[model samples]
Target: GGIITQTPKFLIGQEGQKLTLKCQQNFNHDTMYWYRQDSGKGLRLIYYSITENDLQKGDLSEGYDASREKKSSFSLTVTSAQKNEMAVFLCASSIRWGRGAETLYFGSGTRLTVL
Candidate 1:
């Protein structure tokens, strides 16, 4: 397990458009997570996959989709981009030992802009 990276530092999309974000890692951990960070609120979990080929919705899963096709990557999709919607999507990964996660590392993030 080494580093986690998110692609496209900035993402711009039109209203009602479908947007996708991607995350990649270098054989570091077991679980991956996507979180949405608003202007003021804390980072809200959007989705997570505990194992390869598994996906789970998180607190802010509405209007979004996620997939973990392999251990090295994960992706998220916005079903519909709402005008004026802007936020930072963060990608994180951790090693699951027992019931908790460790060695958690976060990517720089992908900022979304809906116009």
Candidate 2:
């Protein structure tokens, strides 16, 4: 696997504003996923795509948009930012073959702040 790069290490936005985060990977993995990690909580899946141009909604898919732009890139957008909210958005890519053992690589994460 290769490295995953996320844009805007720290993002600040106002309440009710829309925000977008981008991720890029060189691994060319079979699947890519977007997850939200909140304080003191486990990661919650926002979206995932098994291939290019494919979009699949997960638990936190509401109020967000996701796109698998190409084999090496994925993006996520927040439709509306909540007031005084903070969270870390994580991007991950994995190669899952028949073995059921997938190799996953993750980006450092994009920190979001809504004032």
Candidate 3:
């Protein structure tokens, strides 16, 4: 079995400030993703990396940047924290699957609060 780890279970940032989150996995999976979940809302994909050093922008990629520096780690940076915003950022990994049902295992999530 494999595992994924994300640092700093909570994040606090000032409005308009830049914040970063880190994730690591031991699964050796081919795909890793970063997503944002607003209060009571479904997860929205922000960015995904298909391979080391490969980045794919998702529907929610605006105002964010990500990096896949190694096969086991991926990092995401929030370019700006919005006013009165709160969200949980999640990191996930999946094995390579062309089309069918590919399940994603997620991190506990980093809760962010803008003040």
The best candidate by TM-score is: 2
TM-score of 2: 0.94
Which residue runs does candidate 1 get wrong by more than 4 Å? 97-100
Q: Model 1, poorest ten-residue lDDT window?
A: 95-104
Clashing pairs in 2: none
lDDT values, one for every candidate: 0.91, 0.91, 0.90
lDDT of 2 by residue, 8-88 (tens): 789999989999999999987878999999999999999998888889999999999998889999999999999978999
Ranking by lDDT: 2, 1, 3
Candidates in order, TM-scores: namely 0.93, 0.94, 0.93
**Deviation from truth (RMSD, Å), model 2:** 1.3
Lowest-sum lDDT 10-residue window in model 2: 95-104
Q: Write the per-residue lDDT of candidate 3 for residues 1-115, one digit (tens) a residue.
A: 8888887789889989999999999988989999999878889999999888789999999999998989999999989989888888999999865775367988888888889
Candidate 3 global CA lDDT score: 0.90
Model 2: CA > 4 A from native: none
Off by over 4 Å in 3: 99-101
Q: How do the residues 1-115 of candidate 1 rate in per-residue lDDT, one tens digit apiece? A: 3788898899999999999999998856788999999998999999999989889889899999998979989999999999999999999988864666565689999999999
